[model samples]
Target chain A: MSGNPVERLGRGTTDLVVDLGGLARFAGRVVVAGSGRPWRLRRLLDEVFGIGVLSISIIGLSGLVVGLVLGLQGYNTLVRFGAENSLGAVVGLTLIRELGPVLTALLVAGRAGSAIAAEIGSMVVTEQLDGLRMMSVDPEDFVVAPKAMAMVISMPLLSALFITLGLFGGMVVAVGIVGGDAGIYLTSLESSVEFREDVLGSLVKALVFGVLVALIATWRGYTAEPNAAGVSAATTSTVVASSVSVLIFDFFITALWRV
Target chain B: MNVSPLRDLLVGCFVLAGLLSLAYLSVTLGGLSYRGPGGLQIHATFDEVGGLKPRAPVVIGGVKVGQIKSIQLDGDLRPRAVLDVDPAVGIPVDSSASILTSGVLGDQYIGIELGAEEDVLKGGDEIQYTQSAVILERLIGKVVQNLGADSE
Candidate 1:
């Protein structure tokens, strides 16, 4: 049993190294493929529509609800300290700095990242990817590149929508419900939010999360075993990996880029 | 796959709207403006700036009339702040500049108290009367010293 445990540990380490190497090679190939003349704009738009536009309602609604909740809770706490006037600053900073990008990325990972993995996994299981290879069409370029580019373009835009709607939701709760002055809330928000720090940081986070979700989803799908169960597993793994990584990277990014 | 131009157009509009709103929010909420309301540069020297940062608002009667463009040390090693005030706001020659904390324990900004004078200060003019930032620890120490002296 002791020998078996040691061997399993060694095998796990080796698997991790091999997986990292595969991911690096896949990233390299995607970079090398580059955006050539036949820019595949149509395919890219289709992916953007599927990934960004379709996810808007879900992202926007969640942002609104979350903002309202933050305002409600913040008002209750701040009133105790007679600082209720700062509700806008609290809500705006939280949404802009942390919640907006992180929540949007998670939603996109669940909705679009899983879809990417499942679609590619299905292609792999059905041997469609192999068929493309037989036709001398590089599968990464034809299948993955456009989707990845769409994600990179769509994430920051979606995050901006989330933040904008979230601010309105916060205003509704803080001003309409909590009896705070709208002018004070707005002025405080304006004074507190910094463009170079909060806005730029949020966009940067969204961009990184977008690239990560696409890469992980595509890698899992591309390497999926040739079976129906493998496709489902790939979809599940995409959601899990993308969500966890977004959270982990958010912490590091916040620490590193703190104003 | 059938490419729908209508769908693409709608998506493009949605993205463009989002981006425009983002730009608006960053500019308005972030208090970022490029054209500085056509201002004139003025200077004030303070013994200490404390927690004051560059770009801090310059307020008069609680209204933001300008901003601190930069802070540098003069030959005497005293910190001097360069303020850019709206040309519409004419500061009298005897006006005083003071560094003040916003709220109870908030960020520091420059506050200007207008003085009555016949002559109005122009661009490149330096305000003579100035006050430095009040350090909280120093205030507490003074309070403690007063209490000790009373007990003695």
Candidate 2:
């Protein structure tokens, strides 16, 4: 605590590099150890249910609300330029290309990511991870891997649900509430959105976000200081780290895709 | 924890539904329809196609009739666009084709103007009257040149 400022800075940089290296090792172990035997189908299913099914209401509701808001705002702005009919295009493109994956990742990070960190952190505090190590059982496989796999599998599905519900919500606001022609709205949405650029791009983004969220959550939890306060801190770190990484990665991915 | 078959079933169904809906949305909303009615191809040549690309909508009187199938350079090095118009849509032989920008800063599409002719165009027919894209920069340059001349 009494070190020179430059020394402190240098120490911090070394700590960060070491942390990143350890994380990469942990992730590698999860991938390798998670693939092998006693294929835990039951555990994977439970993780999927916990991660995917439970988050549906929040994801769907937010998607619908976001879509509705987009429709309202897009209509108001487009009408001035006599391009009101293109509201569908605006809403569809926004949801599929950017909002769908990004928002779903952020929400899932808040919900599932924190839960993962907390659960694993509590287990660590209880010495369950140490017990597995003592028994020569790989904790990465038994715990982290299943959850990571579940998150990977569930993310794209959730993103699709978000986009689907969002489109319906946009339609409700645009056609039902805003007095826009339903036919035109549908047509414009169909004509403007592309399968590869928008839909696949979103799914790819979701996949990347899912991996980041799960890995960050598990990593923080696995490395927690053996205490209740440590578990809580890890959970908070999961949320903050996942959210920031999602946004930063999103910018890079979007820049790469240019969509 | 007890493994419930019902829960597994429900999870499977949910994932399946989500995937199916995604596929449906991508195909329908993305305009990747494959089982639609048959269409006929018509060719039109232009000096400059600008940013117009294949798959851009081909509209008639503000209604979409088909899409641009392909664009290739002709003998004179002009851009020739092949449009795949729906068979149901009958374009007159004397009709004109022009590249139009959707909005101020939007994508470009092909616009077909109907003509009063008894004979309707058949497949493989050429649209003789075609207008190329209007380059915004060139238009602004011309306007600026005119303004400068007036000031002098």
Candidate 3:
């Protein structure tokens, strides 16, 4: 009442609203950041660290299993109708459209998204965020920006890894058990799938999910009012938000666009 | 000072090599042949193509080399499926083309059975052998009956 509309110091009703405000401000800020900053540094880290290094094993194993099962299941079913060759069409479409993005998002959200929430949440409880604010820095620009940048930049690449690995995985199934040629599987995947629109459509969806993920985790974490419980809440919110947002976006995009 | 940076570098390189090689192996293995690439062009006539789409995989011996190029009816109204075969595969003219399901409740694709004929089929040639899709529910019912009988 005496000084400002709402106290900014510790945690208050105003701070909770500020947390919401910070999230609201992110849309415009991110666009500006995207256009002006271009995120090259973040992209490099995301590629090397977030996607290329950290994600390979999980994506590889997941893709392998998915490929094997698809091949076996597809072959068995086709044997009855004697339409086994059409296996390419089934595997290709499913890998590109459905399993690719959904599986990757879920896996990565479990892996990376949660980690991000916990790390940032830890910072908030430790007062590193408040320290930055005291030094005349916007914690949003300092803490939230870099990691959010990393997530947004890397998601499409991660999604690509998920999808391509899935294809490879499906092929293993195709070759080892289903008894299909490997070269033929790649060809079917390449030709049946239109690259620019269809594959790109999935990648674009991943990018959107990435951005949503970064925002949700950063918003939830960066504003937690310096407490152990707050950190936990932030962590839970990050996972739920990222997973829900990925699914909802997937459905809407699948319905609305040809991609 | 205890351990040289060169030693650390060696370890890093070793790790990197292992990961990259695995990734490469998966790529090469997964790069194996995909079906529906070559001469299986479609010259079929269907009352309704249903969900049948062009460039769909046409499989033979569980390999897909060509696709459904088009579907249209003939003068006598027979469902004519024109196939394109890889010149290398040497599909005999007597081979039969059947529309088969890929999975239990999956999409339909053309299946080819090699015919024991000397002469081979040409680009525009149609295979006389054909089998259509089985109604899924009926097939499941058959399975249930088979299972029940086996139990008895």
Looking at model 1, what is the TM-score of chain A? 0.96
Writing each residue's lDDT as its tens digit, candidate 1 over A131-176 gives 9999998888888888888888888888889998889899999778
Model 1 lDDT tens row, B5-118: 788887898789778868877788776763265778999999999988877899999998888888999999999999988888889999999999988867799999999997
**Full ranking by TM-score:** 1, 2, 3
- Kindly indicate the candidate among 1 and 2 with the higher lDDT: 2
For candidate 2, lDDT tens digit of each residue in B1-152?
78888889878977996798688777887666532447788899999999998779899988888888889999998889988888888788999999999777778999999988988999889998999999999999999999999999
Q: TM-score of A-chain in each prediction?
A: 0.96, 0.98, 0.82
- Residue A140 displacement (Å), model 1: 1.2
Candidate 1 matches the true fold with a TM-score of 0.87
Cα TM-score per model? 0.87, 0.81, 0.59
**In candidate 3, what are the lDDT values of residues A63-121, reduced to their tens digit?**
66786678678778977987666666677677667777778777777787777788778
* Model 2 error, position A256 (Å): 2.7
RMSD of each: 3.5, 5.2, 10.2
Query: Of the candidates numbered 2 and 3, which has the greater lDDT value?
Result: 2
Best by lDDT: 2
The docking category that best describes candidate 1 is medium
Candidate 2: which stretches are off by over 4 Å?
B34-45, B48-51, B58-66, B69-76, B82-152
